[model samples]
Target chain A: MNNNQKLERGAEDIFGNWMQASMDFWNSMTGRHGGMFDPAGALAQAAQSSSDQAEKMWRSGNKMFQLWFSILGEPENLSSFAKGAEVLPGFMTQTVQQMWESFVEVHKQLLSRSTPLGQKAPASDFTQPDLNIFRTWKQIYQKEFQKFLNVPQLGLTRVYQERMQRFVDEANLFGTALAEFVRLFYVPIEKSLDIMQTKVEEMIEAGEFPEDPKELYLQWIKVLEGHYTTLLKSPQYTQVLNNMLQNLVKFRNARNELIYDALGNIPIPTNRDMDELYQEIYQLKKKVRELSRKLEAKSN
Target chain B: MNPPKIAVDLILKKLAEDTEKVRIRAQKASEVLLSPLNTDIATTPHDVVYQEDRIKLKHYKPAEVRYSTPLLVVYALINRETMLDLQPERSVVRTFLEHGLEVYMMDWGYPSRKDRYLTIDDHVNGYMDNVVDFIRARHQLPQINLMGICMGGSFSVMYAALHPEKIRNLIATVTPTNFDTDAGLLHVWTRDMDADTLVDSYGNMPGDIMNLGFLLLNPARLMIDKYMGFFENIDSKPFVENFIRMEKWIFDSPAVPGETFRQFIKDCYHQNLLIQSKMELDGKRVDLKNITMPLLNIYAKFDHLVPPRACELLTQKVGSQDVEDVCLETGHIGIYVSSKIQQQFAPKILDWLKARDGSAKTQAAGKKASGRRKSASKAKPAARSGAPATAS
Candidate 1:
């Protein structure tokens, strides 16, 4: 075979392999439950099918690199190949975007199916708040594109690309921390409030005393408020506070009677010397007025 | 299993006899424990103690009023009014009496189911108006000092505003004037409550339901945590007694009249009309500006039900030139019963009233002295007029 024809055949083979490997890697990385993409092979299955897909994608990527290398060797035909090469980069970009969109759609479907029907539909539950997958994929694509740009000796775009990726990475971390906080801390405290309210109602029914039932309940709220106020000082705790406040309002509305009934029969002890007491109270009032007037005069 | 059944039957037979003995012992113990706490105000020990509509109001001689003006205490209809005179050490009524103020507190008798249709107008203008007239006529006094507690405080504020001429001084304790604040769950719920359903379903809202709602507001401490503490402290006789007393009081809820409840929720909570000076009671505009008498407003700072916000608004809303606002650092129930209030808040309240009275007395004395000087100076002018125009 002629040298040019051999080079063309090698490029074709490498490109074909690269496309297959990219698709496999994307599927493995995005697949469910740590993705075991290969079901039949016991050894591949043992590692996880997702990893297998990634491995296949990696091999395909190597072939694409080889094809690009082969094309690089033929400087005379580089102009003819430029058109196709330009299309390939655009195609990769489009494909990555499509993959991210598909991932979000699937994530939403899974979440909806997993959530119980009884709970009040949370706004966050409709769609995953964390869009880290798209963010990270976009970063990787930008990085790869920058490498392509470097091949053409364009150096300035690399700085902008890195800065953009760093911003996205920080945002993704923040979003992740917020979601984790809501799930772990906020949700549990909200549940605790519910449990606490139920226990209070039970105690009232059972007849516990010394402290007024209403006052006792107030103390509990004060404690909860203190905890939440402290929690709100942290950015991580902000999301939890939001969730808890929402739940608290709902809980309070549902159990409004518990608070009302707590003050139902406040004991008023009226066995006293009413005449003498009134006189003393009246005398005290006289004294307070005198003190106030004197203070006001002094201030003036 | 059969052997166990046989053993159970034997145990059951023995327990049957033992149960009667246990019951008798329990009954005796209950009798002994409850005897001290039981105050049969219904059936007075002596005939001299007369009952007016099943409430024991103190009887006074006609001559007594000539020396001292009577103080009439108006208690909230939701609970018994006995709280003012609860115990000798902490009784507000006792404090007044000790200061030589003739005290007359209205004990709104236990409202029957038929009384559910009664409205705020009926209580304030009807029953309350009649009681005031009765006191006035009996004492031959044109006006009297009015002290109100909780819901009664609101009623008293309304009455004072409506009939300014009839009230000498007004004292409101733990009284809520503003319902829009977020200081308490009651304020929030009441602000947005649908009173129609509550009032329509039950002619009078059950006190138990109200109690339950209050308990739910602070469940952790009110429910499990409180009982755990109670059980731990049950060994102390005084603590147990106090606990039982409070429990009994907590559970002994009185049903609120439906119409009154409806009006209170709509006019006070949802509309927030009271503090705005736009509330109409009995077709008369209750402009708080009309409350020009000396006013003493006391509230609990830590009160969960009626926060300081609810009570302090009274001083700001009323047009009384001599308005006193005192905030006690205690919860709602504690305001009335706490030893701290007895020592501090109650005494302070008494002092405020006495100071007003003292200034008035001094003014009267100064006028009398001036009248004597003028009469001696212009003896012929008094004879010419033939009308004894002494300084009032």
Candidate 2:
């Protein structure tokens, strides 16, 4: 237990505490019993945690350098420099990769078990129509592949390249998860909102009072709540949710003809028809009198 | 100086004077020679019935006596009435003439500032009635034909309803009846216009402002493409001449009177009252049912200014049993000027009028005859009236 050892232990303790706090923040924000977290609050927490970790890491690294300088007598040494560079790169790489992997795995598990807060699927295992799902799926897959090409081979040495390659291979698994989230979770919720808005407008125009206006309003709110829940449970669901909402709006618009036809309040045609009918009755009466005159003449 | 030099100078001066005199004489001779050609070319055979506010009614001589009825041609106030008889080859007025129909067209001249107060009622009731009466009196006919173009078309429809007995045949070309529909940008903007503010500020709505609005409706195509097209075929003299003529016609817009502008927007655009049969011009109910005369509604299919939908509703709303809607494949201006219209549409209109020539007598007999007498008398009084004779 030298000073260097004390610093290293302190760094480990700080990292552990930060990771715990980060997890706790995420749990509170997404917890069922707890009120939904404001997006601003979540963003602030993420930024604070990342900054604290970087600060602690820097302080510990400086302390370690001081301790090593005291022990070595000479400041310039190839082995010391190489060790500093080599060990930290592997350590940091492992830490970040583990964090990302754990986050993704937890997200998947949560999505699988949880239903959106205000909405349930019509039936268990019920899925949205797969009309344009393939288009989005292809786009996501291509984007993920391009992201793979962009990942830096995090190595100044040959041995590090092997480590980097392993990380890249693991990152590729997120692609399928991203695509599934977009198709299944995000799209359906968005489409439902769009449909709800359209229905409300149509109802208003048709002059049909909603059975419960509050319930109609709640339906709209439920869509937004469902979107947030899906987004929290699986971040990749945002794109699909937007697509669904657009489709729902289109569907709602298509229902206007039905609503308008049922109302039957447009004034032009009914008036014209009435006029025509009146004219026909008048003509009929005139014809009857003419026929009676002809009969009278024949009888005479 | 040499004797020949002096003689040469004197001879040259004499030659110049002689050349001047001969040139003058030649000019006079050419004027004399071309005078009859110009008169024949310019003089539309249509007779002038009534003149007021620089607007003259040209009475059309019928080819045959069928129904003692008159057809009034309400040309758009924006252009010279000569467009109805643009040329013998392509004259809408001539077609009506050949069809043995009595036609009366309004020639709206360039209105000076003083003439700006002329309202819609003044044109419809005062001028239009007078022309109708003039025609009625000339042949002792009971009713007259009413043909309106563009703005005039809308005016004619209003007039026909207000004085329904006077109109034997109602022909409206490129007429806008429904202004609420988004069939054209003009309809959409005009539908919500505050016309009172515009009319009150400007006694007569400026023609340039109207022209600018029309240009903006299809800015890229109408403003740019048309000019570009002119430059492309500038070398051909006939093409250039026709292009200049069209350009001149397009720019020659008349100031719409204040009250007329206000009523047009209120009745036709804002309220969409005309097509709805809810409009009242001069306290008289403008009911389309009142327009029970034979209506030959002509509209252009590709008219960007007035869509077919706008004009098509007139046939549906009007009470006429013999309403015939002809949708010509042309633009707004093209209804009058397009070569295809000259070849097809103009002739068809004449034929339609020809078919209904005999039917007018029966229709007018069913309706009031006094309305016809009032309009017919207007035509006769211009000739009989001893006011300063205006150009008809």
Candidate 3:
């Protein structure tokens, strides 16, 4: 068998064993097998079951990687594959691997430095925060998995399958963009809270803290408004917002296309059909109104 | 780092006082909230004089008409025109009527899916022009006073420029003619928006989405502080009633037609074609120089949506020599609802219209009528002078 096929078979075997282990655990936990359930035993069994398959998977995966790298290494083969699939993702794997390491390191630092409430902590250092899990997921998916979605389909349902795949890919991208946009929106809140906490601590130290909760809320909101005003006007926030909106519109269009295709079989009319007819009617009415206005002016 | 040192006794005393205050206020607030409250808005007496395709003209007739020329007010399509008559005392419509000026307001009703194809030309040239013509024909006058608010102000500016011969006095309130300034978040955000794609996906721009955008512009204030204020003053019947009225008006948004939104975002916000007089409607350029009518352009100095820079350039660009600009110290909605600002807003418009009523005899009659109103108010208090005595 080819290295790719062998790798896929190994993956399927590993997945099957994992699913079997999960079913066994659930069945034991529910007492369906009428045994004293041992969670540790179930986990151990699951690990034991997949351990051999993992070795086979690793060997197959190594062979597949060698095959892909060999193909990507040759200038001639690279040009041929590049023309068809945009670019083979082999080139980005090294860069993504580096980024993933540094991303993990930065998050580790952040988690280590996090302080409890009522304690003096340094100002929030979101400047180098690696909060974009979606970016990592996208990179990994692109490097190892996205090509599966690009595979050509056979038979009469080829175009339908292609559209469905596109809809799913677009949805994933849109969701990632939305998450990033929401994270950017929360920056102001985070900064405001940090500042508010610091100021409140200072006030308490100086015996000037307001006793009224309402007054504290008013102060916090004022600071929050100030932070939001600055963040919203920033170029970074604007770009993130635009990206999210563009992604949303694209996702909606993809979804609409799928819906329209499905509606073609039903008796109901699609939005496209209605929109086309509406455009024609609108144009006709506009023309008639123009002509009647001209005729009325002439009569007057 | 050391923990914060707070005085226990101070906090305990304040907490005890606050708990008692909240307990008493909570009881009164519940009683007030449960009772029948008159939170209805736009309670002015008016008739639907005309309507065409989800559009209506509300004619608020005065007790005695002092001016031969009628005033037609066009409000923004983003929200309803009920904001003008939100409350009795702060009602701009009632204030105008009490001053002996006949008013006609345009209500661009909620748009449906079929209305998605409607464009700016359809609104300014088609709907607004038709309403103005209807009013002119009814009054048998060649020209009438035209006023626009916010987006409607921009439409009015376009209408006056296109059909200046039919407009005698033009008043633009909180209008955003120049859209290039980054003074407002809307201007900065809309500049990068793919309006065409948005309209293609969503047939019409939904109102709730626009409200969310507005709330995001000042989330700390609009989303949190405003609610806190409501909770703080929940025990006061007048405050609660007024707060509910405002909440109703703020959320009563109407979806803008797709084509109109696309064109507005592209032409006004992105390209800023209106102030430069390069904006086109139905192949006709909206040359601001065509607006030769006497212009009264008024805007709030503190308006975040349409800043002064956006509204201050029209008088300089328009062809009218008798253009007057008034910048009131208020926010966008405050110009219509603030008790202190409403006094200046309605009177200024009435005086401006009276001066430009085109005939000296009408001015004399209006002055005489105003003098009589002053004496009548002195003899007896105005019935709708302030908030109702009850929790309405």
Candidate 4:
């Protein structure tokens, strides 16, 4: 191997040994994982487990809605068939109304639950019934988010750890931006339910059925547009946007470092070298402008 | 007759009509995009008369010269100034020339990686001063008219202050002078930004990054609603052309020089130092009191980028007694490109300049080239290296 490869090998071994020894000490201290213990690590593991349980439990609540929907949707016994037929449509309408109310309640929670500046919203916030009304969607969103940032590679290798850490930070920023974007995108549709509910009731009272639901959808889009504008101009939106920008810069720097390392071995002038040349020429031009002005003054 | 059947039939008919309309619209949209329509903008004639590195000075000569004093236009570095000459009907340069005035504009040019070391001092004091001196000598006059746009206006204010005798009439359009304002979200966000880290990482502020920030400022209006409006108007030929022209202008952003971007954010924005006179260009303080010329401060009443409040404080802080502030009835870019404003904006400047036009008038008034001699009589043909004053 060449000197660079050897140096990297040396680094990997040293860092790998250090990490292994650190884990062993932590295990001995906490008396877990066969002498692999850090109370912080134990606590983190416990926290992760509990959070998984909570998210699963919270997501399962959708089954309750489904159960209620099915029970009311179909009668178990035929003895009450006449009443079932009479009450089914009204029950379905009421259920839809209740679902909308739940969504609005969740929206209020999202608006009210404020995180301190600089901290990401807790992961629990993502899995809440308020955020995820449907099962398995948040999980999919998170998986895709990771895929976008690239899969986390395993090992104590310096490059792997660095890339993983950078990607994790990027994922956090993307989560915030995507949440805000999706929220605004959902607002228009969520708002249609409200207008549709009202319009349906008015039609019933007037003894006329609303012919087109699409018209209500269009109106919802308009309402959503207005809310989206307000959200876009909000201070919170600006903060999130800045967070994304800063994270983007970090990601760019990481990529630059990796690319520069590879490019250093090649026989090509990099941006850094070009920048140096530019700095030199820029300074020279300034000097020339100053000198030219002086020469003109002297001639005069 | 069954009421349900009638309702169903009516709904289906309505849907069919809408579907047919949309299909026709989509067909037209495809054809428009596929077939190249004339997307021409900024077609007015001009020559690159002077060069300093990447910077170019363009002069647009008129068929008739009514005024003696030539006006120099300075545009902001954030975007190109092609918007001033967007089209035949809406060209600011053409309007000024038609009004019988000689016009020269400063093109900050596309700054590259080599431009990272270009400080604000280099632009305001060095290049601007050189250009001003060149113009003064060309006319063999003591002072000429100066007009600055957006950030360029801020630089002009600083330059005019340092060399007040060189400028007889000063026009500052849609420029931000006072940095302390909460009216714009950009102001609030920049106040807390770590500009040092940003400049260190990127060297130069990437235009794409800046454009993203701008889009986020009003995402619904700029990003979503704008495209939706375009979709609604996609079938209209004129609308499509205008939309593409605007899109071209919006995206043709240049990466700003690193040193200049860094100092602007730190001193002018984060520190709120410009209006306080705490800003130093090349170790010399930028005092607004020295801008005591016949000042015309033009600002857009509804400009979101540079709010009216951000610009209104200039006249209050300036030391000029003859300063007049005019609030135009449009946003920032619209003041130049809007059809209604195009008819009025250039003429307003023309009238203002004619009143104070006698300073550069010579025995050869109304001539193609005015009496010369303090320096070169004509704008020098640009050289390849962009070295300053090579034309002279």
Candidate 5:
């Protein structure tokens, strides 16, 4: 064969080989093969899992809202009623629907971009598509997040606004943290892909064809792991993790406040009263135990 | 002439092989994920000897009791005692029984909202001491063997120190008595944590929240690589079953009592008061120098939770002449569940207890030698025999 024909064949061969290697990587991700180094797939899975968890959380919160409304029977009859009580259920339902849709859309987008970016040719011009994904994520995040800020407050004004506002604010903080966590999978891919692109092109120029896709994959994982491990082991990461966790408490407290407020209107006892009783009983038990021991010592 | 080049064909061949390998792996993984897994963990047979509120004292009387001195196993409050008996073959309790030791375990069952006010003083001095007294009285013995694991080990240490006369021998495994070291992330995190806010919000610290902290401590390995390893070895029934059992144990964490948690984090973790002997419970100080009993402090070499430095200083601080500090080459959980660790450590404990048991057995022999020689001879032989099988 002529030199030009051989070159053409070589190009076809190179592209074909890269395609097969990419498919192998993809297979590893979808559980079609051993997922030794499938961080992106794992992140997608996490996002999907979190989406489901968030839905369950919303459902539970709605259940509390429904129970609150049912207990009152006639909201208008109450002497001191929460103004937001009327719209709270519908508001929560609408907010949850928006949140779910927005989250799923982001998840779908993440999965779509993940495979395409991973399958890109090493010799081709690599456009860091993470920028696009981030932009899309932010827009949806902001839109859905704004809905939380408008949480139908009980009794309006400042009575229940603190919790409602804090819950929304915590969501924003947590969302930011979760976004960074998900980006852990993407950043490494982008960085490693850029580096690998250079290595592959150089090898081509030198007429050296190394069948080291597996090695390349392994190196990428090492790089990814190294970056994450450093971040995870840092004091800064600890603070961030703590911040995220603390916000969860805030969110819970806000939700509980909403429930407890609604429960207050009725004659039934609440957690506050239960807590006081428990604390009192606990102190009495300790005191009784102490006194019994002292009496036994005296008798002896 | 150049030899025939087959670079393209070679790529195709590699692709074909890879595809087949991938297909095989995919099928195996699917089978694993879809198939029902029967991971029967913590299945050792035992009877509840005593009960108090939520707490139950379990006596695992072997088919034949080998040793007269009963060893009470106190597990960490974070996890269940089931960890020691995770599997039959790898059970520490079973290994101890085979060696002729009568074992009793304290099941500090799920602490409810009512238990939020329970403190460390209540656990170590009240519940633990009560259990010890009950065991001593039941057997009509002066002292019984005491063994603690992890946080339970810490409580055991405090108990042994305060009431050293009640314990014959003390064994602490993966226990962090010295909480001052910056050995683990838990230490660093808890040091700066807002414990007041946390305890106030949750009343009882949720196990799931504690789990998150532990998970984050080694997220790269524990979260990512470990799961990757699981996916790789999904086809192996033994591996999968072991993995699931471990999962159950890890997630089966109990909410720590708020008062107990508050004191532990503030005094032990934040203030580093335990080792300093500055920690106080119910107006009494916990002085480590008071622990003069025969002590066996066993810690894992590669344990991230309670690092070697966290446990290595126990022998130094403790006023025990017979303190044997054993460092097993494994992680925290691996110390109990790993066959190699169980084999190495269980035998060591048995041998140590046997030597201690010898002194007691000889005294009883001396006391009975003067009277009824015929009956005494038979009783002497019985005492000499390995754990005697009684009505279990």
Candidate 6:
């Protein structure tokens, strides 16, 4: 075969191989090959498959590179090279479309599980969005993005990066805990509202609705108060509150660590430095008081 | 049987009347809001006699001192001492002063980041001891009356135990000595709290956070009904002023010293050591038997912060035979601020203090305590196990 013809064939083969590799990675990720929705397993499989496919693509790529160098050296075969590159955009579009479709499907699945008030729907066992919202987000975060943060760092900024990562993780955890805590507050409000609705409906049915609207408000508030009292004293509420507090403390400590590092660059003292000084001063004062008291006793 | 006929016209008329009333009220409220207001708190005149770091000794000397022994009032670190003298009509300090008693209050000024290391020992042994000694020396008396309010009362109990010779009478009002009962939400929630983590994260427990916690204790009443009451009477200048004053006092919280908070929660709430006489400070056990001075333990019956169950056990555990507990039908702050309850509370304290004032028995007790103080280099933990009181 002529040198130009050989170069064109090599270029086409490399494009085909690259497209196939991209399709295979996308397919594995979207579970089109019929496997459970295990992101970690899928990722491992995709990595292994891509490595094997990469070797073949690399060989073809090398041959194409050599052929292109030979053909392009004679300036007349450039149009053929340009023509072979036209397949790439279509493959890129297809991969993006598959990813979009998969995301939509996942979103639909998450949305299908529940009702807004966390009650079970008669039609299906789908949990509403508000129910376990944090858990859902946490699951996605741990599976998809947490590993990126867990990646080992290099060079002099390693400690700084690690501290940042810790702060970020703690902050996320605190946010989830706080969300749960806030959800408890809403529970009383929701239940009160539901009660109010039924009471009003009953009143309407009996034609005994109060003329004074303030009475209704007063009644509603009493209902709300009752619910809140029950909720505030509940073990579940206390557990959520403690969880939030603990998480908040962790977040604050993590944040303070980063601040400590940052403050090292500035002239201002950090809490740790000030705390040490305070401790010494406090001890010194205590000793002075003790000594003074003893001296007074002896003098008396 | 047929249902009662709906009166739509009556409902509409009532709604219109309510709207008109609201509009009129809003107009008057706007005028009230725009006008000058005297919402200032802690306005009772007093001089700062002694100062130690953030701690200050306030002397509220009456025109005529009825009692020989000056009463030193130690307030909690969680809030300002201003709650006693909230208003002219309902002032506890004024009542004490009018009854011809010498009053000294400890103003635990807002603690800063540096104050985080200050512990319960520092408060009781350091500041409180110095204040008591200063008062005793200034008044030329060997012993003074000691009264503590709420958390301050807890400190007073500790102080009276450690330095019984310096205290002729010990009055703990709305104070929490026992921590085993789950009668109050504070007792319940604090039992599980990681106070070390809280204090460590925020050097001194943030005042705003503490206030938020207090609000959570009764959000329905404090958060909702209280404000609703305000809107209902927004046009009344007097009501508005009092509401604002109370609001200022309630929200004006100070950061509790971190070490003190950690020790309190751990030693008292978690371990239930205070009433058990197992609580130790500055290497000395707070033996309740050492608190042999005339003890008057007063607590609010409806106090959600320091329930009666927490305070009632103190009189039983103490070494003094001359012990009395007055349980008032009031809430925590209500004991001080409620106009109706003020008559019962402050007068009751005055009478109790008066009855104990310079009694021969009290003097003998003080002398015995002085001997104990002179002989003992340190306090030994009490071995007697007192029966725990059930929550009412």
Classify candidate 2 by CAPRI docking class: incorrect
| TM-scores (chain A) of the candidates | 0.29, 0.24, 0.58, 0.40, 0.40, 0.61
Compose the digit string of candidate 2's lDDT tens values, residues B272-313: 888888887667778888888877777766666788888888
Return the top candidate by DockQ. Answer: 6
Q: What is the interface RMSD of candidate 5, in Å?
A: 4.0
Model 5 C-alpha lDDT per residue in residues A209-254, reported as the tens digit of each score: 4553556556655655565455555565556456655766676677
**Which order, best to worst by TM-score?**
6, 3, 5, 4, 1, 2
Cα lDDT tens digits, model 6, B1-392, are 86457788999999899899999999999999999999988888899999999889999989998887889998888878888888898899999999999999999998999999988999998899888989988988999999998889999999999999999888888899999998898888887899988988898988888888887876766677767888999999998998788777777788889999899999999999999999999799999999888887777777778888988888878898777777777677777777767767788778767766786775555444332110111212222111011111
- Report per-candidate DockQ: 0.01, 0.00, 0.44, 0.18, 0.13, 0.51
* lDDT of candidate 4 over B34-151, digit per residue (tens): 8887678778899888898789889899998888889999988887888788667768899898888999999888988888888999999988888888888888989889999988
Candidate 1, B116: how far from true, in Å? 2.0
lDDT of 1 by residue, A48-135 (tens): 6567677577657756765665565454455356556879989888868866875666577546645643444332232223323334
Model 4 chain A is weakest, by summed lDDT over 10 consecutive residues, at A120-129
For candidate 5, lDDT tens digit of each residue in B1-392?
86434355666777788788778988987887788877888788888999987899998877787787899999888868888888888899899988778999999999998888899999999899889989999999999999998889999999998999999888888888787777775676676787887888888998887886677665545665567677667777777887788777878878999999999889888887888888899989999999987788887776778888888788788787667777777677767776666667788788767767736574354333322111000111111101110000
Candidate 1 residues lying further than 4 Å off, grouped into runs, are A1-190, A193-300, B1-67, B358-392
By DockQ thresholds, what CAPRI class is model 1?
A: incorrect
Q: What digit string (tens of lDDT, one per residue) describes model 3 on residues B126-165?
A: 9999999999999898999999999999999999999999
The candidate with the higher TM-score, 2 or 4, is: 4
Candidate 4 stretches with Cα past 4 Å from truth are A1-222, B1-14, B359-392
TM-score of chain A of 1: 0.29
Residue runs of model 6 more than 4 Å from their true location after superposition: A1-131, B1-4, B359-392
Window of ten residues with lowest summed lDDT in model 3 chain A: A30-39
Give the interface-residue alpha carbon RMSD of model 1: 19.4
Candidate 5's C-alpha runs over 4 A off are A1-158, A161-163, A166-225, A295-300, B1-15, B21-37, B358-392
Q: Arrange candidates by DockQ, descending.
A: 6, 3, 4, 5, 1, 2
> Which CAPRI quality tier does the interface of model 4 achieve?
incorrect
